[model samples]
Target: MRILEGAGTYVATTSNHWEEHLEVPDLSCGTYSLPAGGTDPQSPHTEDEIYLVTHGRATLWTPSGSAPMGPGDVAFVPAGEEHRFIDIVEDFAVVVVFGPAEYSRAESDTD
Candidate 1:
């Protein structure tokens, strides 16, 4: 077993947008952050994803429409679906989980 010890602190202090903490064959866990007015540069992923918002407020935009999210809210995005965070009203911090590991399905996607 492994531990991320102080994941929130690391994520909050990191300079990068995504700070990955743990990974195995089927799952990967990390933290995703965006400051108010920051751009969401992420695109669709090869694996399914879930985001647990631990701080701040934002609008989650998908091809279908948009929804507001904030502290304690959770989100799930199926693989290959287009989605992004927009209109960030406060600093956002989220715990991200990916199934089958992030980017792990990219190679198989060709088939």
Candidate 2:
């Protein structure tokens, strides 16, 4: 099995807003963060995604509806669904997991 030490520290120090920490054929994991009141710039992913909030507060919005979020909150978005985090109430951070690994579908699409 693989091990990652200081994963949180690395994510906090990363240059980008998101950091991918692990990946394999079936799944991937990463950390995503945003400042208070920041806009989410992501489009829908090609693979299903799950988010486990570790810090701050926000709202998860989708075509179906929306729900308030905060530390320890969890959310899931299916592939190709329109969704985003909005009304961020504080500096937010979440651990994200993707099925079939993120971008794996994008590669197949280009073929």
Per-residue accuracy of model 2 over 1-111 as CA lDDT, tens digit each:
877443333233322388888999999988888778688878999999999888888899999999998888888999999998899777788888999899988756547
- Model 1 regions lying over 4 Å from their true place: 8-16, 108-111
- Give RMSD to native, each candidate: 2.8, 2.6
Each candidate: what lDDT?
0.84, 0.82
Cα-based TM-score, every candidate: 0.87, 0.86
State model 2's lDDT. 0.82
In model 1, where is the ten-residue run with the lowest total lDDT?
7-16
Question: Which residues of candidate 2, in runs, are more than 4 Å off?
Answer: 6-16, 107-110
Task: Name the candidate that leads on lDDT.
Answer: 1
